[model samples]
Target: MIFRTPPRAAILAIAFLLGAGFFATGAAPPSASAGARLALGGVALAFSVVALRCARMRIVASDACLKLYGPLFNQAIRWADIRTNVAAESGVDARTFGVRTPVIVLTSDRKVKAQPVSSYSFSGGTDTPADRIAGQLEALRQSS
Candidate 1:
């Protein structure tokens, strides 16, 4: 299945940033307010771009290996390297995939190092989509 970024999130981020900029500068409450607005606006803009990019998620499972790529990161996992699929709760606001976080923890028979690839949360659909992707990965692993 294919997953793409949510346009509404990007639009909202831009709009909020612009509106905050205008209102914060217009008011003379304190310079801190302007700075704060600018900071928040910057974060919003950055996240918006991330959201746009991470919106795309691709999962391809073959007997040889499993391939997964979304906007934020990409990985190719061999059947022997990946462990069981784990379901997790995540959300766009929380910067996690859908309501549940979907992740595949890599493992090896010998001592080895592993790292978690953080998932992107850009919209309400993040968690659920991630779970779906995880499901795909598990299916692939089983088939292999």
Candidate 2:
């Protein structure tokens, strides 16, 4: 199984950032130099690259191991190493937005960590998809 960043999240963020840049550059006063407008466009391009990097994040699960792919790195965790999987609220956005994203948590003897590459936000309710995925992964762990 493979889990990916939601397409809607990526598209909306990228479009809004790029649109703002285009509007700012296009509406710059006639007195503004070409360099100023180009700078705004460059900033927009940089933001777009970050958004694209985030959107490409994913996790792949196989019988032997689970593979996580992020913007800058890839990691594999063997099934034998993961003691269990559970659904948990992530505090990453909770403090400011009051929205705690649900993610799959993997616990081992050495560490308890959340799956960093993939999170489910709009799939039904806040916790439904995360719970389902965690349950499935736990089942996989038990069988293997």
Question: lDDT tens string, model 2, 22-125?
Answer: 65566567787888878777776666665665566666889889887655467888887787775545444433432223243446455433334335354334
Whole-model lDDT per candidate = 0.52, 0.59
Which candidate number would show the highest lDDT if scored against the true structure? 2
lDDT of 2 at 43: 70
Q: Can you give the TM-score per candidate against the true fold?
A: 0.44, 0.58
Error of 1 at 73 (Å): 3.2
Clashes of each: 16, 0
Cα RMSD to the true fold for all candidates: 7.8, 4.7
Model 2 root-mean-square deviation: 4.7
